[model samples]
Target: MKLFQDKVAIVTGGASGIGAAIVRDLADEGATVIIADFDEDGAIRLADELGRDRAAPFGVDVSDPQAVEATVAFAVAQFGGLHLAVNNAGIGAPATKLADIAIDDWHRVLGVDLHSVFYGLKYEIPAIIASGGGAIVNMASILGAVGWAGSAAYVTAKHALLGMTKTAALDYADQNIRINAVGPGFVTTPALEKTMTDDERSGLAALHALGRLARPEEVAALTSFLLSDRASFMTGTYYPVDGGYLAR
Candidate 1:
C-alpha cells in the first residue's frame, strides 16, 4: 500500500510552490487532499489536475480564524476524516528595517505567517483527535533560527512559529498526534523566479553550503515523510531541510 493510503490531508497555500508540491506528493501516495489557498483559481486548477476525487479546492484566507476552521471542517465533511495537514501559508514583509517597518506590514506578516498556523493548530488538532490521530507539518524557514536584516516581521513570526510547533507537539504527543515544523532555506519557487534577477538568485544560493536553492520537491519529500508512518516516533521536533545554510 502507498504511504498515505486512506489518509485525508489539507495543505494551505497549496495552489503553488512548496505547498502545491506537498499536495501532489500526498495525493500521489493515496491521500485525498484539500488545496486551500487565497488563490482560488489556482487551487481549482491544481485540484482539477489531481482529479476531483483525489483533491478538492478550498478558497480561504488562512489568517481568518473562521476560514481556517471551515477548512478543517471541510476535510472531515468531504473526505470523512482528517489525517494530515501542512500549514504552508505565509507572506513576506517589505525590506524595511525594524525602526522603519510599517505597523500594517508587521501585523499582516504575523497574521498570515504566525496567526494562521495557530488557527490551523487550534482547529486541526480537535479534528485529528476525533479521527483517532495523525500528523501535521508547519512550513517555517531558516529565519526561524537566524535573523535577517530588514526582515524583522518575517523573522519574528517564524521564530514564534517554531515555538508554537514544539509546544503543540508536546501537548498532543500522548494522543497519537505528531506535530513538527520544517525550516527550509531559499527554495526556488515560482514567485522567486518571477521577481529575482539571475544575480540576485545567485547571491541567495551562495548563502547555502549546497550553493543552490532547494527545489520544492525536496521540501515536499521531507514533509510527506513526516506525515507518514515512517516518522512514527517523531514529534515536537524542528527539521531543517536547509541545504546546509545554517551550517555556517
Candidate 2:
C-alpha cells in the first residue's frame, strides 16, 4: 500500500509553491487532500488536476481562526477523518529594517506566518485526537535558527514556530499524535522568481553550502516523509531541509 493510503490531509497555502508541491506529494501517496489557500481559483485548479475525489479545494485565510477551524471540520466532514496536516501558509515581509518596518507589516507577517499555525493546531489537534491521532508538520525557515537583515518580522515568527512545534509535540506524544517543524533554506518558487533578478538569486544561492536554491520538491520530500509512518518515532523536533545553508 502507498505510504498515506486511507489518510486524509489538509495543507494550507496549498495552491502554489512549496505548499502546492506538498499537496501533490500527499495526494500522490494516496491521501485525500484539501488544498486550502487564499487563492480559491488556484486551489480549484489544483484539486481538479488531482481529481476531485483525491483532492478538494478550500478557500481560507489561515490567519482567521474561524476559517482554520472550518477547514479542519470540512476535512473530517468530507473525508471521514483527519490524519495529516501541513501548516504551510506564510508571507514575506518587505525588505525593511526592524525599526523601519510598518506596524501593519509586522502584524500581517505574524498573522499569516505564526498565528495561522497556532490556529491550525488549536483546531487540528482536537480533530486528530478524535479521529485517533496522526502527524502534523509546520513549514518554518532557516531564519528560525538564524537571523536575516530586513526580515525581522518573518524571522521572529519562524523562531517562535520552532518552540511551538516542540511544545505541541510533547503535549501530544502520548496521544499518538506527532508534531514537527521543517526549516527550509532559499527555495526556488514562483514568488522568488518574480521578486528577484538572476543576479540577486545567484547571490542568495551562494549563501547555501550547496551553492544553489532548493527546489520545492526537495522540501516536499522531507515533509512527506515526516507525515508518513516512516517517521513514526520522530516528533517534537525541527528538521532542516536547508541545503546546508546553516552549515555556515
Candidate 3:
C-alpha cells in the first residue's frame, strides 16, 4: 500500500467530500499529504487524525492566486518536494435554467469550479517542474462531457476544465508532468446527501444507470490511481466514474 512512498501531494478542498477521501487514500498509501482548504478547522482535524508528521493542514482559497501560491509553497517547504496535486476543491451551483439563473451565481460557481483550476496550475506546475516533474488530477464532473437543464454554469465550468486539462497535458507531456481530469457521476457524498430529502435522494439514485449513487471512496480510488505511476499513460483524458449515467 505504500505505492506513494517518498512522494508528497497537495489536495485542495481536502476538508470534506471527495477531497477528504483523497487525502485519506493518499496518506494511507504512504504519501505525505497537505490538506489545503478554506475549512481550516476541518483540515486541521483531519491532519490530527492522520498524524501531524505525515499530513499537514493549510487554509487555502483556491480562487485566490496568492493564497494558492502560498499553499503550494508551504507544501513544498514542508515535504521538500512535490510529486502530485489534486485540484479537487469546488462548489456546487443550483439547478436552475440559464434564463432564470442569477448572473452573480454564474460568476461565483465558475470562479470556484473553473478559474481555481487555472490558479492551481499557475502555481503548482512550475514547482512540480522545478522538482523534476509530477502528476496532477483535476476534478471535473460527468457534466464536463455533457450538459443538463438548469446547470448551465456548473456544466460550462466543468466542460471548460476538460478543455484546459487537455491543453495542459499536451503542454507538459514531454516534461514528465502528466495532467488529467476526473469526471465523476453521482457520487454520494455528504454535500450531495445533505441537500436531498428522502424522496429526492431516491429520485436521484434512480437517475443513475446503476440505480444508486457512488461512494466518495470509490472516486478516491480513481484519484489515487491517477496520481500514481500506474496511470502514466492516461493524461489528457476525462475518465468518467459515473454509473453509465451518460449512456442513458
Candidate 4:
C-alpha cells in the first residue's frame, strides 16, 4: 500500500535495525526518505541501494541540537518539504544496577535516547507545520511502560519519551501535526545479537507471552501506520509493537 506516496520523511538511525526497516518500507511506498544516522557510510549505502531518487543519506549526530536542525534543513532542501519523521536513534546501557551505573553512562544513554528525540521534535515540528500537516513516531521501548533491573538510564529515558510524545501531540494537534511513541519488545537486532549468548537469547524470548522476539519489520509496520493518514485520529499515544511482552 503506497500510503506515503508523494510524501517526504526523515528517519534518524535509518541505517540499520528497526530504523533501516522503516526506511525501506517508506521508500517502497513512494515516500522520499532521508536516511539520517551517525553512521554516514551505512546511510549512504542504504540510500544507494534503495535508489537515490527514493532516498537520500544525511549524516546527523542526533544528540547535537545543531546537527538535528541541519538534518531538518537537508530534508527540506532535498525534498521540497517535510511531512513525516521517526526519531528512532537510541543507545543501550550496560547491565548494571542503578547505584552501580556511572554518571557518565547515564548521561550518554539519555543523551542519545531521550535528548535526541526532543531535538528532533524541536526542529521537525516547524518543518512539518510548513508542509501543512504530518506525523512523527518516537522510538520508545517496552521499558517505557515498565521498569527493568540494571537499566536505570534506558528505562528513565523511555519513560520520559512517553510524556514528551503526549505533550508534543497536544501542542501541535491544532496545527495539523500528530506526535506519538512506539514501544518495541526485544528484537533480534545486530546490537542485541552481539550481547546475547544463544541460551541468553532463548531465555529472553520466553519472557514475552508470545514466546518470541519482534522483527524489525514488525515494528516498522506500526511506525508506518502511525505516520500515515490512516491513523489520523491517533495521537499522544504509545503503541507497543511488542510480541505480547507487556501482557505478561
Candidate 5:
C-alpha cells in the first residue's frame, strides 16, 4: 500500500467514475494526488474527502494544451514534483452510425479522447523527466482495439491512442518514462448507467466472458499498479483489463 509513499500523482477526470476510482486508489497507496477535472466541484469535494493535505484539485480541460500545461505545473507546485499521471478525461461520441456522424462529432471525440493524450504528454513528459522519470497511464477502451458499430468517432479516437502510446514509449524508453493504457470493458459508472436503457444495461453484463461488468475500483487497482514501481517491467503495452471481453 505504501508503494507510492512520498510520490506525487495527477489524475485527469478525477471527479467521478473510473477517474475518481484511480484517484482514491493512488491516495490509498500513500501518494500525494492531484484531482484534475473540468468538474470543479467534484474535484474539490474528492480532494477534501481524501484529505486536503494529500490531495489537491485543479480544474482543467484536457483538450486544451494550455490548460494541460497549467495542470501539470500545478501538480509540481503543490506536491514538489509530479511522478505519475493518469490521463483519463474523455468524452463519448454522439450515438450515431458512421454515415450519420457529423464532422463536428468526429472533431469533438478526437479532441477529448485522442488529442488530450497528446496534450498531457506534451507537458507531463518534461515534468516527469525532470523528476527523474515516472509512469503514465492513458485511459483507452476495448473499443480502442476493436470495432464498435454506430461509434465511428469513438472507435477512431480510441484506436489512435494505441499508436500514440506505442510511439511515445519507443521515443522515451531510455528515459524511464513508461507510458501505457488500460482498455476496459463495459463498466457500470454513473454516466454509463444513466445513458443505457434498462435492457441495454442488463444485456451488457453478458458481453464479457465473466458475465458481469467491471467495477470502477477494479480498473483503479490496475491503474495504480501501472503507475508504480511494482509495474516497473511494463511499458508501451495496452492491457486489456476487460474480463476477457476481447476473447469474444
Candidate 6:
C-alpha cells in the first residue's frame, strides 16, 4: 500500500467524513498528508492520531484565497513539496427552490463549494508545478451529473466544478499535472446524519440501485486512485462512486 510513498499530499475538509477517509488512506499508504480543514480541533486530532511525523493539521477557510495559499505553503514547509491535493472542502446549500433561496445562502454555498476549489487550484497548481508536477482530485457529487430538486446552489456548484476540472485538466495536461473530479452518491457521513432523519436516509438509499448508501472509505478509495500513478492516464474525467444512483 506504499503507492504514495515519499509523496506529499493535502486534503481540504480532511477532518471528517469522506475527506477524513481520504486523509487516512493517503497517510496509510506512506504519504505525508496535511489535514486542511476549518475544523481545527478535528484536524489536529486526526493528525495526532495518524502520528505527527506523517500528518500535520492546517486550519484554513478554503473560500479565502489567502488562507488557501497559506495552506499550500504550510504543506510545502512541512513536507518539502506538494504532489497531490484533494479539494474536498465544501458545504451543502439549504434545501430550497431557487426562487425561494436566500441571496446570502446562495453566496455562502457557492463560496464554500465552488470558490474554494478555484482558490485551491490557484495556489496548488503553482506549488505542484514547482514540485515538477502532480495530481489533483476535486470532490464533486452525483448531483453534478443529474438534477436534484430543492438544491439549486449545491447542484449548480457541483456541475460547475466538473466543468472546471475538465478545463483545468486541459490547461495542465502538458505540464505533468493531472486533474479530475469524483462524484459520490449518498454517503452516510456525520454531516449527512445531522441533516436527515432515519426515514429520510432510508428513502434516499432506496434511490440507489445498490439498495444502500456508499461508505466514506469507498469514495476515498476512488479518490486515492485518481491521485496515484496507477491512474496516470486518467484525467479530465468525472468518476461516480454512487452505488448506482445515476443508473436510474
Give the Cα lDDT of each candidate.
Answer: 0.95, 0.96, 0.91, 0.95, 0.91, 0.95
The TM-score, computed over Cα atoms with residue i paired to residue i, of candidate 6 is 0.98
RMSD of each: 0.6, 0.6, 1.1, 0.9, 1.0, 0.8
Return the lDDT, model 5, position 217. 94
lDDT of 1 by residue, 1-248 (tens): 99999999999999999999999999999999999999999999999999998999999999999999999999998789998999999988658999998888889999999999999999999999999999999999999999999999999999999999999999999999999999999999999888889999999999999999999999999999999999999999999999999999
Alpha carbon deviation, residue 21, candidate 3 (Å): 0.8
Q: Give the TM-score of each candidate.
A: 0.99, 0.99, 0.97, 0.98, 0.98, 0.98
Worst ten in a row by lDDT for model 4: 239-248
Q: What's the count of clashing pairs in each model shown?
A: 0, 0, 1, 0, 0, 0
User: Which 10 consecutive residues of model 5 have the lowest summed lDDT?
Assistant: 93-102
- lDDT of residue 98 for candidate 3: 91
| Model 5: colliding residue pairs | none
Worst 10 residues of 1 by lDDT: 93-102
Please provide, for model 4 over 1-248, each residue's C-alpha lDDT reduced to its tens digit, 9 standing for 90 to 100: 58899999999999999999999999999999999999999999999999999999999998999999999999999789999999999999779999999988989999999999999999999999999989999999999999999999999999999999999999999999999999999998988899989899999999999998889999999999999999999999999988888887
Model 5, span 29-85: residue lDDT tens: 888898999999999999999999789999998888899999999988877898999
Count of clashing pairs, candidate 5: 0
What digit string (tens of lDDT, one per residue) describes model 3 on residues 90-112? 99877898989898999889988
- Candidate 3's TM-score reads 0.97
Q: Kindly report which residue stretches of model 1 are placed more than 4 angstroms away from their true locations once superposed.
A: none
Error of 6 at 176 (Å): 0.5
Query: Which portions of model 4 show Cα errors greater than 4 Å?
Result: none
